[model samples]
Target: MRKRPAEPPVRREPEAPEGCLTVAIRIPVRIVVLVLVVPVRMLWDALVVAGRFLNDALLRPLGRALLWLGRAVFVWPFVALWRWVVVPVGKALGWLGHVLVVVPLVWLYRYVLTPVGHAIAWVARGAGAALGWIAGGVGAALGWVYAALLTPVGYAVMWVLKGLGAVLAALGIGVWTALAWLVKYLVVVPAVWLYTWVLAPVGRAIGWCAKGLVWLVSMAVTGIGTALYWIARILLVLPALAVWRWILTPVGRVLAVIGRELWDALGHAWRVAGHISLAVGRFLGTLFRWIFVEPVRWVYRSVLTPVGHVVRDAVWRPAAEAARSVGRATRQALAAARESVRQARADFRRMLFGEPRRPQPVDRREPSGRETRTLGSSTTALTKD
Candidate 1:
């Protein structure tokens, strides 16, 4: 015997120990949930059964009929139109486009445009080479002119400007030195003395007064803010925090546990109700089969089948054979009458038109009557020489 594979162990979380409060809450919650869920579950199962019955008995057949009707009314006509009319028309149009437009465009490109493009390219290359040679000659002339004529003139201009710049720079240095000495005594020295002795002492004294005033104002503001902070914390924040921590948290936890237990119990009850509904349905089906179906089946087998066989053997076979005999006699009489009518019509035509000329047979084969079949030169299907 083959060894069965060992099943993997399922991992489960360790359950927390329940207190009296949790136990007290869970039991009532579960009972209430079960009571509430049972009727709803049973009703749900009943609806499921009713829906399945409707689907099988009515809706499925109706949908299939509608689907067939839709195919006949909508889909089949369009498919036939597409297959018989649209497809052929589209293929004809595609062939016409290929002949009228695509073929002409391809011919123009290959035979006309290709040669023209090559000729234009060759002309452009010649023009470009000519222009490049002319540009090179003009560039060489400009280089010679710049080196021979512009170089000496540019050097002479630069030398003259440099000498002038040195003279101007010497004069500028002397004027700058005189201006600096005059500015030191007339403007810079008095400004420095006034700032160091007069402005510095006044600015320092004003800054010290502003600092003292700011410190006094800040100290008053800080004392008031500190007092308000302590008062608000004691009156509002601390009470709200205490209520949240000590009262509301415990109440919320209990409510949460109750809700969780209620949800679990509802699920469990629904499952149990489903099993009960299934059992009840099976029992009812068995009872119905015994009460009605078996009796009908027995009647069909024991009573109806024998009576039908007797009727078929005693009455139906003789009636059917008589009907067939009558039909065969009728068909034979009609056939003889039709043959007499055709013979009369043929005799009348012969009297009117005289004897008709017989048609001569014409051979339609690859080799003419005068040609002989030779194995080495055969073109027929049997020998593809």
Candidate 2:
């Protein structure tokens, strides 16, 4: 079996169809004129040129006219506003000018309002007179009605009074009899009943109170006697007791010294413990300050100070720097793309001819051998053997 060439071996253009390619069409002019290429840079260059041309040819004149029109339309209006409205308003507000303006307003007011006020006041006075007459008539009618109604009411009242007087006299007799009976029942009989039924217990209670008072008096007398006896005993024994106590002064001194020493030592010990506790509390407070507050202070200095500075620089300054760098890089990339395109054009020219100045003649010759050469790189050619 024949050996196949290795994969990815150099490729070659297919040979012109067996003998049918004896005649060839001239395609260089077509390729040069009718070819479509992705010339982004060329299009961009054309746009730039067109833009510059448009700015010079069209936009500049348009901008100048627009500026002049704008000056005419807006600038004059802006300039005139202070003079036309603001100055007029300000002048009208001045005292002398305001007084002059007020003259017309006052004249208008007098011409329009004086007659209306007089007419309204006349109508009001007429309405008041009518109302006064109606009020007087109503008053006379009401007075007559009141006098007529009073006679019947007075008669009814007199009749009622006569009946009431007779009934009252009868009731007076009964009331006197009832009052006399009630007085007898309430004062004489009930007093007798209370005296018979309740006074004995009251008297006994009063007697008991008297006995209690006597017993209390007796107890007070005994207490007073005891107090007097104690006072007399103290008066009688105080000197002897003093003498006896004086005799034991030396023994009391020793015992007092011992007791005072014990008390002083206990008091000193308590004071020392209290002082130590206070000092410990103070030291703990200071230690807490050292451990927590000092560290926080140090952390503020070490971290937050630098972090805040960095953040300020990053957020404010570095962002500006990055924007500048990106703009510069974009400009450089555009320049680099232009340079690459120029180099590619130069290379294509070199391949089409030999050099820019001296072009080589093209030959439409058929190659003699079965092997063909193809370009693999700009500097190298590959052959399929």
For candidate 1, write residues 1-385 as lDDT tens digits. 9999999999999998988887787778777777787778878888999999999999999999999999999999999999999999999999999999999999999999999999999999999999999999999999999999999999999999999999999999999999999999999999999999999999999999999999999999999999999999999999999999999999999888878887787888788777877888799999999999999999999999999999999999999999999999999999999999999999999999988999997855567768887656666787764
Q: Residues 1-385, candidate 2: write the lDDT tens digits.
A: 9998778968898985522221222233223322322233335445776799999999999999999999999998988998899888887688666587777778877987887888999999999999999999999999988889977899899999999999999999998999999899889998899988999889999999999999999999999999999998799788778876886786676566556545554455455545655565578779999999999999999999999999988796888899999999999999999999999999998898876566776753434468454454232244322
Best by lDDT: 1
Where model 2 places Cα greater than 4 Å from the true spot, the runs are 1-121, 196-201, 204-211, 214-218, 221-385
Best candidate according to TM-score: 1
Cα-based lDDT at residue 148, candidate 2: 94
Every model's TM-score: 0.69, 0.27
Candidate 1 accuracy as TM-score: 0.69
Note the Cα lDDT for every prediction shown.
0.92, 0.76
